[model samples]
Target: MAIISIANLLASYKSPESKDMWERICKSIGSQMENLPTLEGMRKIVTLSYNHLHYYLKGCIMYLSIFPEDYIITKKRLLKRWIAEGLVAEIRGLTLMEAAEAYYNELLSRNMIARADDPKWTVETCQVHDMVLEVMVSKSLEANFVSLVGGSYEGMSYGSIRRLSIHGGEVVSEGSRSNKIATSHGRKNDIQVMNMEHVRSLSMFGPEDNMKMLDRLGELRLLRVLDLE
Candidate 1:
């Protein structure tokens, strides 16, 4: 029999919709309001906050969903990829990376992503909370902004590859299994897999040795970002 007031709820939630909903509920209760917030109520607040974000910021956040949960995201790499994907807009005589960095800081202020410890004070890394990652992944899939290959992360059915990301060593073909190698690089060679011509951004995690699949990296002509780390 915990008693909670509309004012207290308002203080706890930032979304105006949540505040209004509580106000109406409180009025109906005639000062007898005393109920815990439901999961759905919390979801609505989060949804409201997401829907109200600037389109640019929304894209930035959704792009983050491509990474695995709790992944230590490097701000430098993220900014570079965003710029390469043409997701960042140049502003006020600032470079694309500079502008993108501003957007990153803004997301930090909004609590959409958490900063990681940086002894150098560069704030070069960050991570999305588990709940926030779920929301972003859902929205990204709905918009077909990104497609996840094989991974432990939740994603929809495979579709035409636009921005492709493979977690773990899944994308890499082990030693003899992927004997076929394209010798375009003349270094180690790359794997000849399915058509990746349409893919714009490619992110691969796990061992670097597995990266020698496609003989040369230039084969992905449309590729804007090639994140191997």
Candidate 2:
């Protein structure tokens, strides 16, 4: 039997008032540990503990780093690493590998690891639960960890937009600054120059049609992913 499964069972199988009986039950099953079904493999493993409800919940997320902090964590690798980490609590008759598998399955069953499909599973482009990311970024930002912010929008008084990205067939002109042309209805054209140096990520989609804005972004210098799109 694995220590972690034993740990988990010790952790959940019985309440403090029943620890003695639980340990006795574990000893009886210890020899069969190698063949026992994991919580993940079992059809059901209900919650029995009344304390620290989040022990399992939070534990599921601790290994999230296997995927990029902000990247969509794939189920395959996520499960693989979870197994490799030995984070699973031990059950009397289960191997650590077996226990970790059960723990993973349990997490999936509880929605601790839910649908987190990224854009084509692209690590850099993948995403996660907003609340999860929010919680993560809140802590990260407090530590001054910066991230990517994409696109262009011209708004009132041009607030604090420090970066500007001009993509293929897309143009955002500076108010009366360039003689760029875009024939249209019956209104005089207006442009807005977004701040290009203050925030973090400034991504350009593709096709560098407008080289004029290059200077604006070049000033950013801290640019991360400047795709030509």
Candidate number achieving the greatest lDDT relative to the actual structure: 1
Distance from true location, Cα of 206 in model 2, Å: 20
Model 2 regions lying over 4 Å from their true place: 1-57, 116-127, 136-229
lDDT string for model 2 (1-229, tens) is 1333335545554566877757664554553444555732221122221122356444445334212223454454545444443445667999766666666665544333456555566542223443343333233222233221211221222234332333233334544211111111112312224455663334343434345455565566665444333
C-alpha lDDT (0 to 100) for residue 120 of candidate 1: 59
User: What lDDT would candidate 2 get against the real structure?
Assistant: 0.39
Candidate models: Cα lDDT each: 0.63, 0.39
lDDT of 1 at 56: 92
| Strongest candidate by TM-score | 1
Q: Candidate 1: which stretches are off by over 4 Å?
A: 1-41, 118-123, 153-156, 169-195, 208-219
- Using Cα atoms with residue i matched to residue i, what is each candidate's TM-score against the true structure? 0.66, 0.30
Evaluate residue 184 in candidate 2 and report its C-alpha lDDT on the 0 to 100 scale. Answer: 16
* Model 2 alpha-carbon miss at residue 222, Å: 33
